[model samples]
Target: MLIRDYAEIFPEWVKLAKVACVIPVSSVPAERGFSLQNRIKTAQRSRLGEGRVTRRMHIASSRDTLDTFDFNSAAARFTAAKYRKK
Candidate 1:
């Protein structure tokens, strides 16, 4: 019933709703943590203890900066600095 009358009775509301949109955000960091765990616990190194594995995983994930680290620029800058020091 509500669905059928949504456009007729709530015409203004529908128009306002149509003009706006919604988006969902999520924590990609948490997903990266799980991925790190799997990679760390692979066949050859499956004997790792839970606590040590969790700590290592957390450190690795936390170091993954979303911005601020540009590998190419950093490498160029490092090379330039080293060359100047000579």
Candidate 2:
């Protein structure tokens, strides 16, 4: 109520408030990420590095379903990489 009345006089504060309001009040997203990381870094594959973990997290959290994802291009890129061992 008070914020609405003073928004015109204090535009900067209003912008800050709007940004703050969008922030999550809970840590559910962070918790989910940690949980995904745990599943990706299990005992048998514990040697995975931070870069691998981050990339895996991004893939795991991607909004695109498997059917919509272009796996052929990804496979082509992987096979084209000369750095990979035979």
Candidate 3:
């Protein structure tokens, strides 16, 4: 609000403030991602490739919304794809 009110008088400062505002205020998000990766890549599953790990991470992160997703359609598409492994 202060930045918007004095934007005209402090154009450069306002620009700096806008950029600073986008900078993360904490490292918790990054730490959480790393922690999730650690949990997904346990010693027993350490051989999993990067692509598989990434897909697992995406699934784990979005698990909260899985109930609303169309799993039937996704399953159909997966089975209909010719390139998919048996």
Candidate 4:
């Protein structure tokens, strides 16, 4: 559908009929998953361990809505708790 929408902009070598728009649609879900992973690894929390990072990332990515996750507040609390022990 996307290819058909932007057929004009596509390279001339790509035959319109032969062009398959399968990747983008399939990748959107994976892209969203990666986006959730990135949000968990922002500048402030870049030093987080892989195990904890992956656990939080999985939860954040699987949820239907990010609003319910409250990652920012949780991350802040986590940071505070860790720092208090230092």
Candidate 5:
């Protein structure tokens, strides 16, 4: 941390530090979904059910920034599926 007076003297350095801070400290989030598949798909979960566990994987492993699914389209598909079957 710099004193307010010192910060005026080193404005460029402060800007550089701000840019560097944006860089990720660790790259874990990039590979999180794949890395966590085994953890989420435990031996007990795998044997008890197949489709049940798979349905929840996307929610469990997806990045926090990407959760805006279009439920309207999914609901439309659900309605259309029944008519197509007949």
Candidate 6:
């Protein structure tokens, strides 16, 4: 009723309010993203470019076992591919 009443006086606000109300109140996913951003956008690397940040964020977000990941096999595969005759 209040929204309908405001529709005439503030049509733009009513539309925006309706949209805002439909959004989920929980911020768990957004908070996780914020934490990831903080980890990647450190004070030391403040000037890191957007493309680099996006790439690193993608890398960071994709994997679950990064700490124990096998770099040797990955490196070997990369070297083999890089040296493969194209």
Q: After superposition, how far is residue 50 of candidate 2 from its true place, in Å?
A: 1.1
Best by TM-score: 3
User: Pick by lDDT: which candidate is best?
Assistant: 3
Each model's backbone clash number: 0, 0, 0, 0, 0, 0
Question: Which of the predicted structures, 1 or 5, would earn the higher lDDT when compared with the native?
Answer: 1
Off by over 4 Å in 6: 1-23, 66-73, 84-86
Superior candidate under lDDT, 3 versus 4: 3
Clashes of 6: 0
Writing each residue's lDDT as its tens digit, candidate 2 over 1-86 gives 53689898998888888898899999998999999999989999899999999999898888789789899998898888855765
* Reference-based TM-score, model 2: 0.61
lDDT of 3 by residue, 20-77 (tens): 9999989999999999999999999999999999999998998667679899998899
Candidate 1's C-alpha runs over 4 A off are 1-27, 64-86
Candidate 5 C-alpha error for residue 46, in Å: 2.3
Q: Score each candidate by Cα lDDT.
A: 0.78, 0.88, 0.91, 0.75, 0.72, 0.89
The residue ranges of model 4 lying beyond 4 angstroms of the native Cα positions read 1-25, 62-86
lDDT of 1 by residue, 23-81 (tens): 32676867877788999888988898999898888767667685766899879999999
* TM-scores of the models, in the order given: 0.38, 0.61, 0.66, 0.40, 0.36, 0.52
Q: Which stretch of 10 consecutive residues in model 2 shows the poorest summed lDDT? A: 77-86
Tens digits of per-residue lDDT for model 6, 1-86: 64877789888898898998999899998999889988999999999999998889999998859688899999999999989965
With candidate 1 superimposed using the best TM-score fit, by how many Å does residue 72's alpha carbon deviate from the native? 26
Q: Output candidate 1 Cα RMSD.
A: 10.5
- Model 5 steric clash pairs: none
lDDT of predicted model 4: 0.75
lDDT of 5 by residue, 1-86 (tens): 74345578999888877788799988887677557666777777767465656666676756444367777887999999989999
Q: Which is superior by lDDT, 4 or 6?
A: 6
Across 3-62, the per-residue lDDT of candidate 4 in tens digits comes to 467567765635644645333546777887788888888899989999989899876657
True-structure lDDT of candidate 1: 0.78
TM-score winner between candidates 1 and 5: 1
Off by over 4 Å in 3: 1-15, 64-66, 83-86
